[model samples]
Target: MRTRFAPSPTGPLHLGHAYSVLLAHDMAQAAGGTFLLRIEDIDQSRARPEWEALIYEDLRWLGLDWEAPVMRQSERLPAYRAALETLWSRGLLYPCSCTRRDIQDAVSAPQEGAEPSVGPDGLVYPGTCRPEAPPQGPMPDRAVLRLDMARALSVLDAPLRHEETGRGPGGETGQIAIPGDSLLRAAGDVVLARRDMGTSYHLSVVVDDAEQRVSHVVRGEDLFEATPIHVLLQRLLGFTSPIYHHHRLIRDAAGKRLAKRDDARAIRTYRDEGLTPADIRAKVGL
Candidate 1:
């Protein structure tokens, strides 16, 4: 029943973030399980000291507590690198140099009447830099690494599946079986390591969860679509899958989802307005 509230300290916490943390904390407390506060500061380019401090302040203001010596992604680079190397050794990873525009152009160009379609991870990678053979030797600097989805699936000894307590965009729930063709179309050649950041969210997240021994994953429903990819990575790396609970998102007034850029809904803004912890809990319908 171990749960975690992992937040990237790239900006101020918002109502949506408040809802997620509160839900995760409550779930852990109810089960008498461990509740961890993980700082996902992998995006070093945008991560800041002040923002990290604000995350602590906001969580305390929300009346929550977590285990000490909170885990920070930046400090776990070695672990992530090890996992990437394991996949690389298995001939699962390949270097990619394509930008967003390059992927769009390739996908846009007709190929056997297969029209370009968007996937869970946004525009399914066109595999512009995917080499016909698995790369060997040292990984290149400043080059993104992408998973070979087809090869990864084919290597699986058993069918990949995950238990979903929350519904997906298409209202899928219960135990979901991951088919080879579907995953390739939904999240083709997903990036494992970024060109600049050295590690991407998917790789870090899966590795972090396994290391933390998280038994349940409580997060926003918006991430439901990406669960299969995470499950695939977990299986590929010989890690156990955690029960997934994707709660509903806290959207804005116009039915838009809250984002880091939406300072109007930031927890700091509400605190400055003299709102109490109870008020925030009620506002988020906790």
Candidate 2:
């Protein structure tokens, strides 16, 4: 029943973040399980030390407690590298040198006026770099490592299941079992590691959760589609699959989910404006 709240220290915490952290903490406390905090600061370009310090200050002000010293992703580069090498050795990875324009052109030009659909990863990659073998010899600059989707799917015929128990947005309690096909489609050849950072979100998150021995994963429902991919990665890397709970997101008055850019909703701003932790809990209807 152990659960974790993993927030990237790239921006100030917002109401959306508070909902996620409080949800995870409440779930763990209800089950008498451990609650852990993880700092997902892999995006070095955007992550800042001041933002990280704000995360600690805000979470503490919210009355949340983690089981151990925070786990930082930047300090775990060797783990990511080892996992990447394993995937490379298995021929499950290939280097992609295509830029965003190249992917868009490949998709739009082939199908006349076809509207592009967003996958779990935001952009549905046109598979422009789905090659037969790893690009021979050495890797090039500005390249990213993409998983071989078809090859990975061939090894995962059975339906993967990760259980979740929570009240839906409408106050209905239910459980969900993620299917394998959804995983394949939503996570189509996602980037495992970018040349700039040495690791991507999918790779770093799965590796960190496993290393932390997390028993339950609770996050916003927007990430429900990515669950299958995490399940698949756990299986491929021989890591244990933790239970998952995808809760509804906290939205603004316009019914739009909050983003890091919504400075007005930043938790630090709320705290500075004299909003208490109880005020935050009530705002999110927790």
Q: Which number leads on lDDT?
A: 1
What residue runs in model 2 are displaced by over 4 Å at the alpha carbon? 112-115, 134-142, 167-184
What TM-score does candidate 2 get on C-alpha atoms?
0.90
Give the alpha carbon lDDT tens digit for every residue of 16-88 in model 2: 9999999899989999989999999889899999999999999999998898788999999989988887777
Clashing pairs in 2: none
Clashes of each: 0, 0
In candidate 1, the residue pairs with backbone N, CA or C atoms under 3 Å apart (3 or more residues apart, or in different chains) clash, namely: none
lDDT of all predictions:
0.91, 0.83
Q: Cα miss at 15, model 1 (Å)?
A: 0.6
Worst 10 residues of 2 by lDDT: 166-175
Worst 10 residues of 1 by lDDT: 164-173
lDDT tens digits, residue span 114-230, model 1? 978687778998778888999989766667899999989989999988998866767778898878888988889999999778889999999999999999999998988788899
